[model samples]
Target chain A: MTLTSDRVEVAADPRQQYEQAMAERWSDGVPLLPATDDAVEAILAASPYPADHALCVLPPRNGVATVELIAINAAMAGVEPAAFGVVLAALEAMSEPEWNAFGLTTTTSSVFPMLVVNGACRDELGIDYRASCMGGAAGRGSMTIGRAVALCLRNIGGQRAGETTKSVFGQPARFGFCFGEWEERSPWPALSVRRGFRADQNVVTVHGGKGTFPLADIHNDDPRDLLYLIAKSLAFPLANPYLGNPENGEVIVAFNPMWAERFGRAFPDVEDLQRYLRAHACQPIDLWPAANAAMLADRGRVDPEGRVHLFERPDQFVPMVCGGLGSLHAIALPSFGESQMQSKAILSKS
Target chain B: MRTHGVYMRPHQSYDAGMSDPATVWVRRPTAAPGGDESAPAFRLDRAVSGLTIGVREDRAWRSWQLIGDIWSEYLRRDGAETITVETGAQVGQPGSDDRKQIDELAAVVDAAVVGLGTCGSCTTFTIKDAVALEEQERPVVAVVCEEFLVHGQNVATHLGHRDLKILVLPYPLEARPDDELRAIADEYYPRMLELLGVAS
Candidate 1:
């Protein structure tokens, strides 16, 4: 493997590489690691697929994501070669027919793939599952792997912010978002296990999250009281759940480990907790302007009691135990409402 | 040290003094297959005149509804019967209801028209419905805002319908007034008919 593409070669120094890429408008305004031959080949050697193996044709640009191409971007993002499997798995999940990558890559909405890792690889890959897991953890896997995927979307898929993509106010997560579930601390099955993957399997679940909204509560010790308020917050009038048809999309509610333990003690079963959340996740119809309320009625969203459920089914409220052991805070990754969260197991090196 | 399951290999030193630095071996990304060559084998012949046309309006956009309505009126004036359908689902977010509506519409109409593929997802859904209509052997024309003209065509090719008929209207069509939309109707109507192969 060597630097052979038509892409111009400049001084191999990091400073020169940055200048060259920036001058060509290829840099995502961030300094990129030089994708030298040794760097790209090292990443490629970790892939189970052959260098020429075709992943999927990325949308907007319709660029074919061959293994070698993905490695180049991954290398530039400073991703560890061993974690290339997770990056590939995330891209495979997005290529699923249901994920609606074609729609997501080009949407005017500020949505991006929120990668959630599960299984033993979380520890192995150093995916952040503790304090500031969504960011600020400074873990290598959490930082570089997600950035690699984002660079692929930018360079290979050509999802330039204002030029190619109509993404109005593109969120910070667009740069790359990867987090892990605190599976050991959860009462129920881990996210991947519940999604039908083996407990030991490395899996990446990609969700089209528009943005993250943090929820905090200093009081209300009772589980029901806390959950009621949280569920109500999840059903914000302007959220994607209300804006688009809610039957297809799902939301992820990340509970700090302490809160998960409290909720688990009260409900005993995860389904029960999901049901309670779904039931209370509605707002009174009067909460919306009359015109909007009428529109909700037309979609069969508002009920006779002037209430509208956040989603069509209880299972649509995905609860995952994550973040630190803090008791007062949680987070919600609101869905884009048009796509499904898809999971793909990472391929073990053969 | 391999901290997380990943570890980087040490970089090979680059000689900064070399005049012709070795070319970087980045994988060249492949473009969409069969560009411009995958035109549909079937073109509209006499299927459009006195056509029982199904007009699909994506609910997310305001312009498509007006465009469909105006087009339907002109088609009706041309001795054709038009049945208009509005999707309950948001653009690019088709559900079972949307599929059912498109299927039912395909069964009854001789041809179909779907619009407002100016944005990302909406354009995908517009092509989706248009492909469904074509699958049923009904001639279909996907109308998109000029901004998404290439995108709509690319999606069609990706869906294995290389020759799908596409009508590109000016961009920012949604914010235009009724008179402007009507003028657009008058200007593009014949071109659309020609694309549909409506016989004089």
Candidate 2:
């Protein structure tokens, strides 16, 4: 019997509850599951934190995200009770100062929190890491978990377009963007392990990404040549990498399993592949207008030989293996330079 | 359907051991108010005459560039040297190039004016760059649109520089005419100097 006015009174029917919730402006233009008290508590039962425990203060509205409130939103987003820990971890990661949640939520750029799930739960929760993993794949965990986080940002964080947030052309991923890495198919260590987490830890890494940049090739079979083309593609002239936060802003290159295997055969070590990409991910100085070129040159992004490297160092480009068996395509998730990728491990309730 | 328990009604409960479902209450989450911490105030001990001032422009607000150029002229007429640094010509991300320029300007300038903290991320970075200049011991006045005053203040506190000086301009300052921009430069110049602790 909560006394808060936030609670809605509806006929004792799931369909009616959903209708009322939408009329109340809670739905993100999609159908929502009834977040009944019973449903919310069931989701909260899987979390170690108490119901009233405040996890993080979301920005824009500065809402306090208590475990209970998040559980309600999660339940409404259709997240299964067992997968509640991932939602908690994603919120925790976004709350990190380096993630710049305050700025990102209100920016005009079409940036959103891109959740990369890892560890054993990726398989159990059905987080998609195969073809069309970013979207169009019908993974329940991918859909519900991502939507829960987005709803949290909208409802809890108070991010509404044309009102509080001025996000011009907010990307489609803003609705929901969660995917898993194809770690088993990769020749290198998993993304979490590479980032210093244990291989078995259920970790969620959040990146402030604008949108997906797709790449495809059917004729190129040479490994170095394919990688070189991929590197060049990553260095899109107007990409955020050119904004100059090379040290903090990271670009994620998602390679399909087939391409990953082919590239793996050529460069046995991941570091070698990174080095190769760094060498070729550059543009001629003439790519920018003269005035802009002079400015870019001033920052040492443009070398004496008139080549402008996309990033300051090779390590800034993160390579992960994922996507379907199709060998011809790759995707570049560009960073929103002001925010850094933050990762946190999920605390499984034993 | 065959009745299992001696002619049970269609709507009647068959599981006798099941307990009534407990209804849970949904409470709206609390919103945390902005923090009140501010950085120590920085003061300029000299007048604007003969002093080198750095004027920063956020390209998102096209008018800021015109205003910055106008302000530079005004400062030059007043016997002061001015250098302008335009950040984020294309986007809000302050790349290494933008950062290096900020640091270099901080090293050389006696005072600074960072402008166009009208939007969300831009305001955050505006405070960031202004605080960095303050850390360099250069007096700085962060110029923000009136609508984002509280946002700028909040970002300042979050960045651990709550006391960073802020100069609030009109809310919708973008896309104004050149004359209006020049007028803005004139109107805000005295206050900007005052915030920077520069005597007339």
Candidate 3:
């Protein structure tokens, strides 16, 4: 297959090539693999779309992302041919209007796309879902796939920090973050399945997550008490949900396998668990200072009981089981407030 | 020269005598920027007396709300009917309603001043709302803080509205006292009208 992207000659020396990438601002402050024609072609071979297909217009700059361009970036990220589809799926999901990529990409907030994968390919692709899956797992699929998407944003979308994007304090996930759900250990159906995809299909769900908010509980063993505390913690006064409309966004609460089992036993239905979490995910109007309280009241956010609910519906508190078998810790991926989580089924050239 | 799957560390020694050192070819990753085709900007080019004007304010910025209120008062005093709308949500039903309101305001008002682009996304939305009015053939001006002036312009340009009129207010409008905000409102009111092509 013929490649249509602009090609440039570079030094044979690895060190010199790395320096060239850095000098050209092509690297994300990390060494990237050279996107040679052979490498780029290999990635393109795995894509469902043709090399010249304009996939979507990424925002901040509204650059047109073509399959060939995405493949070149994927090659630079060292993404395997088999994993290129994940990157494609992610961009498609983000381009959805409700995803609000235009707003999220340029916001002063620390939000970035966090990819959660579910499907039969998880194990084959080495996507980590257990034991420090979010970080420290060093899975090739997780690292390279996530980095590829970030590179696409930087290169194709033109999302430059402090420039095109005014992100105040970009979080670590900006380097690229992808993880899988432990389907076997989960009490509910896989996140993709819950979202209407089949259990067997590989799906990528993109969340405009602000940052990983950690919650730990060593003293409480009762599921209700633990869930209550988790809900309250998510409703921290400064959360983006409290700052704007309560109807938008979802806060992903990740439970370790052990806690999932306990919580699952208490509320067998995932929707019921979400309802429980939503019921407690609120704070009294008195919790805020007069000014903030007045604003909340003015916006009709304050309830008749003086409680300001974090979200309007149960589904806004999305729950998924992941992480290590070790209990007592859960991670909350806070929302960007305006963006809705979007999912797309991954399509690959079989 | 083309090289594939070559692994040579920086510490490894290379011999010049053994032919030319291997070189590789790679594709440029960045996408090409969009072309510079911008839409036309409208102007009222008439007096404000007996005309209706719209002022769009963001709920997130109280300072802008205060300034918007002051500007509304000024417009009324100048014998112009004023309609003001406060928008907060950027997505969901509220966001849809806000966009609809801006569209309706564009239809009814001869001109509009959309403001409080102090933050990143807010600036984008501010320019977007202004563009909506401009698209409807209504004279409009987008107001942004000093810090987000470039961001607002960039968003406008990307949306193919490069010539969209923008008025830059002082940065960090928040945390300032009401009197200071009022002074700023008074200072920038004339320029806002000027950008909207309001005649002297």
- For candidate 1, the iRMS in Å is 7.8
lDDT of 1 by residue, A155-224 (tens): 7776776655778799999888999999999988899998999998899999999989999998899999
Candidate 2 chain A, run of 10 with poorest lDDT: A1-10
How well does chain B match by TM-score in each candidate? 0.77, 0.78, 0.88
**By DockQ thresholds, what CAPRI class is model 2?**
incorrect
Docking class of 3: medium
Cα misplacement distance, residue A177 of candidate 3 (Å) = 0.7
Off by over 4 Å in 2: A1-7, A13-16, B1-26, B29-66, B69-113, B127-142, B145-184, B187-200
Residue A285, candidate 2: alpha-carbon lDDT = 90
Go through the candidates in order and give each one's DockQ. 0.23, 0.17, 0.49
A-chain TM-score per prediction? Answer: 0.97, 0.96, 0.99
Q: Model 2 misses residue B145 by how many Å?
A: 5.4
Q: What is the C-alpha RMSD of each candidate to the true structure, in Å?
A: 5.9, 8.6, 3.6
Model 3, TM vs. native? 0.96
Candidate 3, residues A1-350: lDDT per residue as tens digits? Answer: 99887777777678888987876678899999999988998999888999999999988888899999999999999999999999999999999999999899899999999999999888988889999999899999999999999999999988999988999999999999999999899988999999999999999999999999999999989999999999999999999998899999999999999999999999999999999999999999999999999989988988888899999999999999999977889999999899989999999896
How well is each residue in A1-350 modelled by candidate 2, as lDDT tens digits? 23222444343456555554555567788878777677787888898787778899887666778888888789889899889999999999999877888778877689899999988888899899988899998788999999999988887876777555667799899898999998999989998998899998989999899899999999889999999999998888888767645556778999999999999999988989999998899899998998678767766777778898887677778899999998788999988877778899988678
Candidate 1 or 2, higher DockQ? 1
Q: Chain B TM-score in candidate 2, rounded to 2 decimals?
A: 0.78
Native A-B interface contacts kept, per candidate: 0.28, 0.25, 0.73
> Whose DockQ is greatest here?
3
